[model samples]
Target: MGRIPCCEKDNVKRGQWTPEEDNKLSSYIAQHGTRNWRLIPKHAGLQRCGKSCRLRWTNYLRPDLKHGQFSDSEEHTIVKLHSVVGNRWSLIAAQLPGRTDNDVKNHWNTKLKKKLSGMGIDPVTHKPFSHLMAEIATTLAPPQVAHLAEAALGCFKDEMLHLLTKKRVNFQFQQSNVAPVNTTHDEKDDTVEIIKLNLSRAIQEPDMLPSSKPWDFTGATSANFAGACNAFPGSITGFQYGPSSFGNEGAKSPWSQSMCTGSTCTAGEQQGRLQEKLEDENGGESEGGKEIRNGSSIFNTDCVLWDLPSDDLMNPIV
Candidate 1:
């Protein structure tokens, strides 16, 4: 059987509700309530279809309709709900007292999605942008080091998620009061010398690095580590910091040059040289700095490293 149309297209009015039509619809519904929309338009002398009347009443004519700008709390609730329910805008709207499904959908497309993207979050997946980029980067890694790349990428993702959700991450390195190195010094100066020592130690035994996990970056090679560092400019999680701890000038650390060039020195030789430099600079390690031997400390300072997991990168509600 062929389906019947709800109303005759020739006879019914279309586009834009008039004051008379609004008053007619409102008066009819007020008098007898919306028991039958199809019958109400006819009884109210409105040339509009039942669906049109229904939309007009529900979206605009309703006495309880919220017709102002959406509040911040309301916008947040909509975004949080949308993350879980996705494009099921009607369901999301149901949770919000005054919003309609169309309103919610429009707001998400026009406003909220851009806001999330600006924060480096995918609006649909609710995942960090850097995390997604890292996943793609790991696939290009050599098979022998693929697992290491995956682990390192996972750590990076977790760090991004932690930063997005928790607002702050704890690590000795991140919290330490190391003075920013003067970047204007000669390339062979003490600052550059210290950066080389710290970079070699960081690359050789990332497992010993104090972070969210001790061995999160265990098998990462110097080349891959340097690439990761370059890929994320300021912070491990791709967050921006005023000054980089590796050197004063953010990603332009002196050690990055050595790593990028693939230094020929073995890990043992690098470690030895790094230790000598550290001793020379500090005039011997402090009693509290014993952790440096185990690779638990770098840059001759107590500091924390940022790391993250692959799953649940953002809080479900945020």
Candidate 2:
């Protein structure tokens, strides 16, 4: 069904509330107070619908409404609020006294947008153009395996560009004490050289990539690798992201999730035995374990973590 209109009567007045009309609406509300907006028009004797009357009061005729230019502090508040809430105008307006959502929306459309753009920031994303593009590139980059024999690597385009650009920017800084670039050298050629140099280096020395995360892979992980407790490889236990993602917390032993326990068995047999063991240990809550019967999580969780170096590494190209 179509949405019901707030008002349907043709005789109801529309647009341009005159002083007498405003006076009548205000006087009635002052005495009885705003409760049911639908009944306000009838009680107040106004020629407008309840919805129109509500807007007329809240957006314009509110007693506490503040007029005049938005102060610098207020403008900063709007920008900060906007960065967090996006386009929730009513929320932004509530933070500043005497401002309506309409007022805040108009000011942002007319003024704040231009101001942010002039400062080289994206008014929507609130990031510098270079940084935004780098993030976009990374998310969009297709997963590529470095080699069938290597552990798969997850790449960030942001890191690659950051490394490339940092070299160009710091070449002549005072702290660096490096000699200035010869004016005759083309900047374009230098950038191309850096890209080519690092593109190959990324494959061989992925750890050198800034902010690299170890467990990120390029494609859909095989079902064999998928944990019963969690789909992500970061948590072999399958309960959470795990104690430490980087392995910097020191390695835990017998880490591979292989079900084989010295007694030789088929892969299928091993899996069945593992699942039965887990169900018995966890009292039948394996997929997101309930109780760790053996005083360790996740082992009440059975999963597979492949032994490495047979992993391929990949980073974004763009």
Candidate 3:
């Protein structure tokens, strides 16, 4: 027969702590501080277990524990971090200053984990769910894992191609929208209510700029700026893509409407050029606007018209 279970019938103290017990434990910790939880009950003159005392101090009474709503940045950081670290909340907490392991754990389980899963990211592996799962089965799974692995592999293969194709299409669309921009000058003689028709037009069209495809990092993370605390070997590095691969688009993303929902390049280029000329007259200086005007910026002296409303748009002299 198996040996008798330890403490099965032992009269061990358990359950909630009393007010008197709290007072005693609090006073003892405040004076002596807890060195060993197993000896805490004996030293503090309480019947409660050492584990109970430790939990009470760490979870409830710890002075540094911040019990409040997490800020937006904090929430974002937590979601990003969880994507890399998996469910190791204690390790995750170590990186987040003023955050408790229990709080971080609850936030992940109740909010971030579910949100990422909804966005097609596997909370456990922190990648396109299919990609992460397939990689896992490939590395550690047995021969029997084939049947179970096929679905994930097929899904990721299709999605990867689809996303890549979509990005290419977006880039093509943006390139096709480039147009010629021009500015017109007018001379006025306000004293006699007369206008001269001798005007000059200068074309300011920006060179054809390359497109930067967008990344599909819809998944929430645990940490935003910092690296993951528990990043393991072969962990899906930096969310979906490698860290070195991230590049910011110049103002407009390739997939955004500004790139995709436009006419052919020649037509768009003309309209964009015309728009830039008008915007320049009205003092517009966005990078896209600058591109349309063939000028680097609206404030650039190369194309700025000294007359008309252009001066009103420039910053006043100090």
Please provide, for model 1 over 73-150, each residue's C-alpha lDDT reduced to its tens digit, 9 standing for 90 to 100.
Answer: 456545554554567676556545667778888888987775555344567766444344344444453442444444
Tell me the spans in candidate 3 whose CA falls farther than 4 Å from its real position.
1-9, 18-20, 130-318
Poorest 10 consecutive residues by lDDT, candidate 1 = 303-312
Which of the predicted structures, 1 or 3, would earn the higher TM-score when compared with the native? 1
Candidate 2: tens digits of C-alpha lDDT, residues 131-153: 33333334333333223112211
In model 3, where is the ten-residue run with the lowest total lDDT?
Answer: 195-204
Candidate structures ordered by TM-score, highest first: 1, 2, 3
Q: How much lDDT does each candidate structure score?
A: 0.49, 0.46, 0.41
- Top TM-score model: 1
lDDT of 1 at 176: 26
Candidate 1 overall lDDT versus native? 0.49
